[model samples]
Target: MEGGGGEQALSADNVRGIVLALISSGFIGGSFIIKKKGLRRAAAASGIGAGVGGHSYLLEPLWWVGMITMIVGEIANFVAYAFAPAVLVTPLGALSIIVSAVLAHFILKERLQALGVLGCVMCITGSMVIVIHAPQEQEIASVKEIWKLATQPSFLLYVALVIVMVSVLMFHFSPLWGQSNVLIYTAICSLMGSLSVMSVKALGTSLKLTFEGTNQLVYPETWFFVLVVSTCVLTQMNYLNKALDTFNTAIVSPIYYVMFTTLTILASIIMFKDWSGQSLGSITSEICGLIVVLSGTILLHVTKDYERIPQSKSIYAPLSPSLTTRLTGELLDHVEDGRASDEEKVLRRQEMF
Candidate 1:
């Protein structure tokens, strides 16, 4: 019994899944640097930047190469989901953020602050906690079961909230706060990212079962998940591109990770009931893991602290006659009062004169 349990704990499929996820994250992280370079090249060649609604990057071969590499990473991620629970897979994406940061430091010549390194360490610690306490994936028989979960009132309410938040950010806030606030764009992308994550899991399940001869493709439920996944991913990619162009990756990467991971975990809890059968200790550990991850994200964002320091307005203020009025007045008064010394000084200075 002990040997069997041990074997179950470290199944080959889960091991394969972990390896695939690692590879996927490496590629995805590097893709950000490549794509950004492509965008810069495109913008230099043209007048408009990608951030302000330009698509010249699409014409750049480098951009296409980045897209291809990113797609390959995404494919690996999708396959990993079939073999491992999302709780195991999603947090691992933080590895991509670290990759992006390191790459940005070397390639983009961005400085990695001391706090930023600490943040990466916190991220790793949190991921370990989360992985250790993560609840097991449920046995899924059909795509229809996942559809039922999606349509449930609890999950429906969650979806409704996400839609409302995303809508407010896009339609209401994006017009006014979009340019100044990085959150506006990153929040939108993260919200859509959460939805995309859920859909990806559903679709991945269907494909996995189909590959095993169950033929899940015949179900309309599978098709619906595919469509939702496609829409959400496209929407996320569009806004994410804008955010990456406008904001520093150090800032955007962490904030995006915090929101996306938090929301995805929430969605999973609601839809899959991942915590239903878990002990209180496990649940508490999961929450702690989340906190640790958030702390790391905050620390990473601290690297942008230098940008937040207020610039002095005096730099632009021109010199004025009145600017030194008080000092000049005091000096003038002293000189005037000492003028009597001129008579006494005349006697002393007569020899010199």
Candidate 2:
């Protein structure tokens, strides 16, 4: 009876997590539009932009509102992780891409071409597949256990690799190409994001256990997780702001989602081994889903580049009768003024020229 009851409770927890994730997606999606508007306002007023490393958006009230919204959404997401597996929680973030793209189309006056729409559908489909096959969260009892998993050689190696690459990207490539290329900013955010998520999950677990009376707060390891989450979140926010200010939101959201989601999943798989004990077919399906995601990402970038190619104007376009008549009248007026006084003629010549 106790075992049955525990299973039932786990099911309920999963449902609750899903609801929280959906709500978080909506808030995060809307926050993108609001913050983007704030960035635009700041740039227009201060003649500087976040893309150029400007901090003027810090002064914009609307930006603060967006930041608050994001914080609320992130809090919800943080809790969702406590209730469910990272694989389940992370893929659901594809929903935010839909929200951001739709809002950008209507509010920001950004056009999402047909291919871009198709790409979004593919991304969502892939994410849903991954979610459906996602394994349940591994049971964690204490912050010490999480700290142990984190200190494993494999996970530590992943952390080291992330730190080294981020340093190179930050110190070398960003100054030379960040403004022109969207990937540089997005990459930095995504890389930090993988580590941040692990830390967030650790902290969330710590808080959850504390609430349940285990009192995880006493451990210094819990505080270490807290510090990591804080640094990573701040870093993500900084580069994400730059990406938004520099590129189209329609473009930034999905690319960031793909990169972030992919890296997070990799990190989770490495740390949590979320796929362990899964059926072969289930694992195959997840791989297929990732392929679909990559295809969608490529399609989106190609479509965006295609849209940028200027259309050739037709030389044989017909003029309206009114326009033709107006041109003829103007020509006749100029023709009729055949001669003038020397001074006036010279002035007229200057004006015409």
Candidate 3:
């Protein structure tokens, strides 16, 4: 399955990547639920939640088990990067969100509201749009070229802004609002994720070039990127785990997806100019897709419960326009009768009942 224009043909590597992504999603999803359960148990024993002033989860064996599971997923994800395009692998993380949502419903008794489901759909749709139209990884002539990209004024400025944002989030916002707001922690993780992606891309390119016998391992810049990637990833994982402990697992996944994907793509565009080679139509589609994704995140945040079956016979009718229309059809048989065929009228009457 070759992609149109600049896309990699689906190869064995791509297939292997997709499979690993699926496995990673399953493990990561289960890990989140298990860890949250551990956190809850710890918080209960400690007489406070982590968001407030609890730390007993630090010694919880279950939490450590979940952490080990997550590490396995991360290792799989690391290998995935070597196999597939980032665009392909990153958006596929939606599988983890779905897994988390379903597990939360069963294990945590947390419901997935209709709006949240819609949000997940929109997020997945937008991510696919971005992935499909995304720019292919540029061929790296050398690790030095990557260093040059990192040192570019625009990217340097972006890095500086990320540092400032993370600082404000940690030192300024976290102290005052950390207990109540999941954003403080999630924001830190997402900001670092953007930087980590850049470093990972550089390191990935280095490895690829090295595999090709270019021998990039000799370059100090390659090792520098590796160090940057490791630091950023660890920081992200720590904050992400904290976020999982503090908020509803259902909420965390979509919000994290929206934040992480949006920032990573933004950083990639800024640093790599991935859009530079794309046509205006493609760029417009990608932007529109991202907007759709943002809309979904908003929907997730504003989640309302789905309509449930009424337990009583009173049948409390909703005030939605569709409900109103359904009710109106019951009384307007005379008006609508002649306009419909016998079959249509039968179905209409059936719906009214």
Candidate 4:
């Protein structure tokens, strides 16, 4: 069937892609907390961290477990991208933010405020909207067809812009502000990630077609995509480790998700014209859905450090306004104290490095 301008019925392939994306989100979300625990353990043992160019996390078993889990999730994600449009597959990643936030609250001792809960709800609602209005996947018969799409002038311009920005971040801004600012490292990872995802989709399609009896391995474009995927993945992993080790998992996950998803969608629209046949209303809805998701993610990022003030009395017990104000003040002081302690420890470790 041709692509529709309205809500298209989910094909079998689309269903498979959705299921795999959900599973991938679960694994990826949990991996963030597990890996953070490992990073803390490694820093305690070696007096350094990935943020400060430390390599001790490689010796930590828990870190390896997290890495393996993420790899599995990414593999599933790769296949989903192959079968579905990026517009459909990319926004679904917001589910992982929910997973990460809940896990971080329980496991990492990061308190999720009431706003955080609302943020998670917004992410889910937005994801559902995108799923309902998602554009249909464009059909491509061979790896070369994907290559042709990728090499189009519009996509080439985007590729060029990404390269230039990445170069500036790596060579100039990174040296000056990378360690101090979370955005520096996360931006690098996100930019590289967008390109890597495109390469993954192409390579995945090649493998899928190959398994279906047509040989894509004979083409140089297939191998070229493999090379791009390899390089981009490595770059993303390196910088992402730095971001994760140096910052709160709650903050890193949502920011990375937002940036990566946005760029991947932009690249897909440029390269594949995924929105070509969509109705204006459907397109507007998808954009609104994306905005809601981004708003939720930003809420998560801003409120990740906030905790609900606990009350001494329960069962609808009344309290004076003065008492409530005192409790809230105490909570703020406690949170600030904990943040200061953590920062002090990181500074000491960086000095050692």
Could you give candidate 1's per-residue lDDT for residues 1-353 as a string of tens digits? Answer: 11111212435566666778778878777776676677667767776544334567689998688768766776787787766666667777666666767787898676789988998898789867776666666778899988998899999998899899999999999889887788998798777777777888888888888989899999998988878877886677667656654554446556776777777777878888877767777778778877886787577666643342222111111111101000000000111123333322211111100
Of candidates 2 and 1, the better by TM-score: 1
| Local distance difference test scores for all models | 0.65, 0.66, 0.63, 0.70
- TM-score of candidate 1 versus the correct structure, residues matched by position: 0.69
User: Which 10 consecutive positions of candidate 4 have the poorest summed lDDT?
Assistant: 323-332
Give the top-scoring candidate (TM-score).
4
lDDT of candidate 2 over 7-103, digit per residue (tens): 2123555666777877877777777677777766776777755533456778999978986876677677778888776767777655665676678
Report clash pairs, candidate 4. none
Looking at candidate 3, what is the lDDT of residue 159? 99
My TM-score estimates for the predictions, one after another, are 0.69, 0.66, 0.61, 0.72
Better of 2 and 3 by TM-score: 2
How many angstroms is residue 60 displaced in model 2 relative to the true structure, after the best TM-score fit?
11
Candidate 3, residues 201-269, lDDT tens digits: the string is: 677668877888899999999999888877886777667656654554445545766777778777877
What lDDT does model 1 reach?
0.65
Candidate 2 TM-score, true structure as reference: 0.66
